[model samples]
Target: MANASSMKIRVEELESGMITAENVIEPGTERILLLRDTILDSVMIFNLKERYNVDEVYIRKNFSAATVADEMRAEIDIHQSLSTLKEVFGSDEDKPLTEFSKEATKQISNVTNELITSLYADDNILLKMHQLQSYDDYTYKHCLRVAMMSVTIGKSLDLPRNKMRDLCEAALLHDIGKRTIDVDIIRKPGRLTDEEFEAIKKHPQNGYLLLRKNGSYSEEILNGVLMHHEKYDGTGYPLKLRGEQITYLARIITVADVYDALTSNRPYRQPWSVAEAEEFMMGGANTHFDYDIIMAFLAAFAPYPVGDRVLLSDGNKAEVISNNTNVLRPVIKILTGENADEVIDLYNDFKYLTLSIKCLDKDGSTGE
Candidate 1:
């Protein structure tokens, strides 16, 4: 999307004829009250003041509401949640496992509350999460991203508010069992032996037991943590629960967890490209993951959206005009080289079969 020039203003300062540059959401929930480009009138402004807890909104800075298009984009702030997860999940040789469980339970509750609210407001939150690729403190950031994606998938299924809260919390702590394992086995540079791999597969059960002992988490949260590793085809570890036998939240988290792992920058390997990761996820439906959750995953993740300037593998820059049946292979207008301004359908065209997008240019520079 084209991020239109906008300025943030207080709700009390809102005036008639002003246009919203972003979706306005309900406080601490997934409900949306107004969409981007909604022109404000006196009645709408009054309702916002009397009924909603919204404090501020982004409005088009230099254009008339009558003429301006809603080319603006809103994104969730992940840096704060990342910092909080680091605080809860960060390695501290001195911190005891019991203390870590208690602390993580408390902090994750607070962070995921804010995540649910912000994620629903921005339709492109999954794309933003994809851009949060970094190499430092992998576990902390991975858990946070998993929580984000799980909430997004839940929103696509229209999960209830309480279930959404539990889903986010469970996703955040799904790997808590790893803390109880020996550090050597968890961080082994090479492939694990059969015995060591067996120990490694004990994390989900370990996480479930640790949190259940605390008595602070719900059964939904506990089961989600335990069964998140379960597969739809009865091949996963800790338990071979198949199909609907696995909890619904766990199934959702399973899809989110695998996608984040595949795309994350791990110390041992390079991260997969967005296109490759999505293709892999699509191929996992009904075996590695549930078909419905996989569908939600596809609906939530749009690595490339309209108006994005992307770097193609062929050493050219292109502006995404629209996504075809296959979102990763979008119709693009070449912005450089002899074919400048040429629009190519990457999904249907045969000559451009070898070309693919490498990554996006996320410099925050507005106007192509």
Candidate 2:
């Protein structure tokens, strides 16, 4: 039996290498399925779901703060994913989309599987997403970041396994159409001409065509790629489909696509702060994006999750204790001076309303 302190999570939440807190037994017999303190792996998790019909299991929450953060990082190899993407995108320069379809789908599918695994492997999904903010303007990196954000949002909405897998792949390939366009226009430092913007808008249709040509992707994935640019207010390009008229997965990807685009640095403009980018995302909920998906994105893209140490505006240090309703103004415990360990609810407590988080603390110095 799990102790009171052990966190009980659903089977789908299990991560590789997480130690079991208690014995998992077969339903009919007294036979123990897995012993207590068992280090979990993919096979054990699958059997727990399929063979034993286990819905939830207890895991030891004994990792250090640094180790806890590490669980969410480097799930898929960035270099490997980028290398595979470059190979596929390179085909756009030499071979036709048709020529690379099979190999591309196979490799992308493998990466998507790893992406899903990495997402589920930790409790701090937003932390993983937040770490993605510092990425470059490379097409592969942008697509990868978008896929991570979209999947994080999808997980927040409780999307099923198959749908989530489809969503990730769609987001990863949503910008695939850009590969077919001329490199100069895509990377130009100056503002785009109307003709160039129009050409950029064709990416969704182009990506849809490329994936559809493969005949391997699901309709949900294909539609997501085609309609990711569709706005909620019917103002976006291509189909201009609005509201729920857009496919569900496409709607999810739309929020993530815009968020990643805003946060990522460009040739012409600097990257927006995470808080600034999130505010923009929240502002566009009903017009530029789906309201529900935007809400999910907010919930999943916490810039300051609990357990993160931060530097305060007034030159103090604190650890985030909770990320209540307001993502920016979370409950925090001051780590400086006389008020050490005192919890302040930045969103609710009026006494600390004047205070603000400046940035994440690389080192929790007392600001002395």
Candidate 3:
């Protein structure tokens, strides 16, 4: 059944370019089959009915007037909600179990709901969200970022609606166990002792126990929270599960979680540059991460985001105006030198093979 603001129709009746209003769910589960705002074509419609056995889909009441602002609002709402949750949780250090459980469920639900609503609305929304971030609260912002990225990867893989929701919830709450750890250890400004590092590794189990004690979340969700830290190379924490032993949802969250952690600023180290983070993930492929999921993560990000000033191999400076189908290459609009104002399509031009991005143009300097 569709929500009151949306409508439902059989997959057979879906037309090309009609936007899905809600995530297409697998029957009787939280897995997401297709994401909302997915513009359906004939093949997709066929696949929905045949390949995945999706019967009907929910669609927004109107798409004619949809704008990027709607997606922006959803992003803002998530940040605001997370901020509120932080305040509520911090108000009383000795708050009851019911209080922690209640607020945790409410905030997870709120954040994931916003993620579901705005995920497929526009490809640019996540990039825009990144630009709007403030580094005040690492846990709240980091969890939300991981949730969005995990959902993006899930949608790319065509995960069922129910599984997608589960993935989102799992990723969003994966760090909830940090609440139980000593604040001094969790927020330490310096590198930790070996004992403290061991304490840090206990978060996954602590989170799993907390959620299980809450008595509301599913076993799958608990497993996801418990195992997201397990490595593909058989070297992670707690039980040290490896390869296929880890849950698939945890596998997806692992990639997103590590990527955000590497790229985000922490007290002990400066944030890795985006290029550095991407390279690090690729290098760890098949070792720290599932290879296929890493490829999907690669596809989800633009190394040089749109609007960045870049120096080209051909002695020209340009702005990344838009992306092409390739994540590494983009359509650049030249800003200086012989090709000023020229729109260069790196994926198409024959000479593009000989050229590459030299560096990002920073204030009066070029940055790698």
Candidate 4:
């Protein structure tokens, strides 16, 4: 057995390679179907239920209950941060900042600090704490996600503490200029005219000017906001800065920005699945995004988030239970087909069956 910290699950739900947390006994016969600490496989699963008539088994918990507790706390912290951001930028449309003394600005920094602290507190709790948001208040929601993602990339890069803080702050406010844009265009349900698209492109410059006028932020922060739209190949708007000319902070945020934008639901389109988004980003390497930052992002966030339902190449649908080092191939709890509720690691089972994520279930989990 894997100690007392195990969770009991049904026999049908047992995943191959999971060490038994407790002994399995046959129903009404008192016969031991399986011994403690046995590694479960498909063969054992069939024999235990069909031959020995066992209905349940136990497996070690992949994560601790404390992770759930930490997630709850993180949600509260994120809520507080969003509230502060809303107060600062919600109604400030067309009213450019002339001074930097507002309490709201300081509160935004404080909120970022708390978020950075919480993320560093536990690596496992990083993506586990993310909460899905409604389509309403899209600006605040998007900015928050970008901030967290940028911070996550910074952590993966093992950046200095001060650099991480600055990166997160810049990420959180990178889209502040969008607040001043006309809502009709921002949320247009159809393709924009050339003029409308041009208007949208002005947001980065608008955001930079607004922050620079406030006179409170460092040049790095201001540049990050200004140049985030700048692409590596010099095709980006406003500045068209290429390669090293683009600020490092801006380059990092750009990867996070494009990722959040693509994976999120907009008025014009549904959100892409996690797999699709990652594939898109990977395709953009060196052309639309910096290759190094893109690689850092891949290391930071897994391609498939836990609990996402995915259709497999073999025509089975499964819920992701745990991630392996290989992001594309995770351990899944099969939810349907002949192997209902059984778990398997796609990476390890390559010889038996070819596996690939067909598509994510749209209703069950957030693709981000």
Model 4, residue 327: what's the lDDT? 69
Number of clashes in every candidate structure?
A: 0, 0, 15, 1
**Tens digits of per-residue lDDT for model 1, 1-368:** 34445667889999876766655666776555554456666666787778877887766678654332221222224566777887776574534355355676678888887788776666445544643555667787788889888999999899998999999999999998887787778778898999999998999999899889988999999999999999999999789999999999999999999998987766666667566798899899999899988887886676676766788888888888988757788999998788989999999998999999877753321232
Error of 1 at 33 (Å): 39
In the range 68-182, model 4's lDDT, one tens digit per residue, is 4554455556768787877777653435443344575687789788778877876433442234233456778778888888888888888898998889889988987775577
After superposition, the stretches of candidate 1 with alpha carbons farther than 4 Å from their true spots are: 1-80, 90-103, 123-132, 308-319, 332-368
Instruction: Looking at model 2, report the run of 10 residues with the lowest lDDT sum.
Output: 126-135
TM-score of 4: 0.69
Better of 2 and 4 by lDDT: 2
Q: What root-mean-square deviation over C-alphas does model 2 reach?
A: 13.8
Ranking by lDDT: 1, 2, 4, 3
Locate the minimum summed-lDDT window of 10 residues in model 3.
91-100
TM-score of 3: 0.69
Which of 1 and 4 is ahead in lDDT? Answer: 1
Candidate 3 residues lying further than 4 Å off, grouped into runs, are 1-72, 87-103, 267-269, 306-308, 313-326, 330-355, 363-368
TM-score versus the correct structure, for each prediction: 0.68, 0.70, 0.69, 0.69
